[model samples]
Target: MVTGLKPEKMAYYKQLHAHAWPGVLKKIKECNIRNYSIYIQKIEGKYFLFSYFEYVGSDFKGDMAKMAADTTTRRWWKETDPTQIPLPEAAAHKQQWQIMDEVFHTE
Candidate 1:
């Protein structure tokens, strides 16, 4: 997560994430992404979310492609994409999620 949603929108955002969308959650599981969680720090009424997920599948690219091709996933992105801040590269095109580097992992 980049920045906090507006005060009025925060509640709705929290509500939706409380029980993530079924289709989106299902697609994540299908892609072998597990032990996923998002942490938030609130400062001056602003929220910042740090998310982490384990990738258990062998073919990351293939799985991502499969997820991207899903209609449900596309629709889900449509709903949440507007709320997110894309990186400069991502902003130049249609990217639902951006890749992040893994600095360190114990296991």
Candidate 2:
């Protein structure tokens, strides 16, 4: 699941993420993240993203650490991070974005 982001910054965010940088994509794959897509709702200017992947690799933490340590990933984040509002658990700071409780789910 993704988090809510402001509408005004939507286009810039979308454009950047539309074609994720090669390095960034490589880093994500290394981290076991795949089949990711983000969606925007105009009525309330909210953002949503969905990702699915197989966690076959054992070192989840190590993979994440490696991804975070990448210079290219850092640079990509610099551009798109501002446009995102991560949930509480994922937020860099408390005020950045509030985590929403899931009320429903269907498979």
Give one clash count per candidate, in the order shown: 0, 0
lDDT per residue as tens, model 2, 3-74? 666667887877887778999988888788766555665444456543334455679889868987999999
- Model 1 RMSD to the real structure? 2.8
Q: Model 2, stretches more than 4 Å misplaced?
A: 42-45, 50-52, 92-107
Q: Residues 1-107, candidate 1, lDDT per residue (tens digit)? A: 23334455566666678868899999999999999886566778665555788889999999989998999888876766565555556456655345567787685
TM per prediction: 0.74, 0.69
Any runs in candidate 1 off by more than 4 Å, and if so which?
1-8, 42-47
- The most accurate candidate by lDDT is 1
Model 1 score (lDDT): 0.71
Report the error of model 2 at residue 41, Å.
3.8
For each candidate in the order shown, give its overall lDDT on alpha carbons. Answer: 0.71, 0.69
Compute the lDDT for candidate 2: 0.69
